[model samples]
Target: MSDQHVYLEEVFSSIQGEGIFVGVRQVFVRFYGCNLRCSYCDTSETRAGNPVICRVWRGCEPGRFSETLENPLGVDIVADLIRDLWSPSTRHVSLTGGEPLLQSRFIRRLGERVEMPFYLETNSTLPGAAVDVAGVIDVAACDIKLEESGVEDDHGVLFKRSLETIEIFNDSDCLVFAKIMILPKTTVATIMPAVTSIAEINPEIPLVLQPVTPHRSNPERLIEMMDAAGRYLRDVRVIPQTQRVLGVL
Candidate 1:
């Protein structure tokens, strides 16, 4: 394994809150840094340099108990922690980030050493890095960011790149799915490109419409969004952030 260390925000076991793998137990490895600035992003703290402290679960107890360690933690140390947290029902170690592909090299090294399956949660804007690490991942939980979301980059440029990344996953045997966040003002016009992109690539890939948490979610609007998606895609569903509803981390 490479000796390169990784800057982490946190590493702990939790049930996945959204998308296809909702409620599946996972050990989340949250890295720092992202390329975009979405308007409703809640994980604002994961936006910068290596954290001075990393939070990790200390024991196998059912109740939450965590301990802190210095940042830029070693790969071997993280691998050991993964082993410590392993269990029969544990699905995979999810590599989530402000954008995990930003640190693709570190992820490649860690994935090589860890025995558990690697689940990648990415923004789908880094096609090059997505291709670099896609073969090793067991699942590609990608996002189709909308223009109205207030991203930092040019909307078309980022959207094209995300589509390219999705196209890569579309051809792979590895599971691929899209997570599109629906805002109050979100309409069929805002969702067509994302829907058409997946349809043009491979229509079988699941499309998940996740509503922004703490917003006034109109059921009728969600159905309309799903109807918009069904025009181009086959399997479309509306799933909210269940972890927030269940009051879990």
Candidate 2:
């Protein structure tokens, strides 16, 4: 874990397949590491070290290597990278990773350099870190993992912290979307409390309930899981991995 600059696994342009930005074309910056070991993680390899080539989307061959950047990039250099990735159809930039909040300061500085809106995809476990740069970000797509994800839900304490960070961005012109991944093992009993809690916080915040992709798990179980999740989360809808469906990068 080098501290000078963040290690990146891949960076490519792709459709924003989840959250409010779903289907929107954007540049994805996938950083190299993470703190959590959720059972359903699709990017499990990202936790340890950088990979030579990254499989960006379904059917698309692994994206080839480009130059890697060290952390603490100057605002100008960061701006240039954004420009290089930019296209006429690009709507915004998505700063994602094993956990982007881990590099909050650098991400914040990078966000300051870009003229376009920036979106952050985070696990929402690091509220303190996220709050530091919440003001600079234009949108936050925070994931609130349930106990079924093999993570501790703790009566929604982690969820609450994420909401707190969302509130910080409420007054800014930024949009915040809370995402919950529903797995085969998740139950009605388990989901209601969580959905109710989110509804209580702000029902209008746009909750995205996604069925766990058929990455390492049984695909047959997805329908059952979606059925259970749908019963409780009325505002929720299913969005499978679009990249998988489209066969594109």
Among these predicted structures, which one has the highest lDDT?
1
Best candidate per TM-score, number?
1
**Candidate 1 local lDDT, residue 89:** 88
Clashing pairs in 2: 5-70, 5-71
N/CA/C clash count, model 1: 0
Report the C-alpha displacement of residue 189, candidate 2, in angstroms: 1.8
Q: Tell me each candidate's TM-score.
A: 0.94, 0.80
What lDDT tens digits, residue by residue, belong to model 2 across residues 99-156? 8888887777777667888888998888787777877788888787777788634636
List candidate 2 segments past 4 Å from native.
Answer: 1-4, 49-75, 152-157, 215-235
Model 1: weakest 10-residue lDDT segment is: 57-66
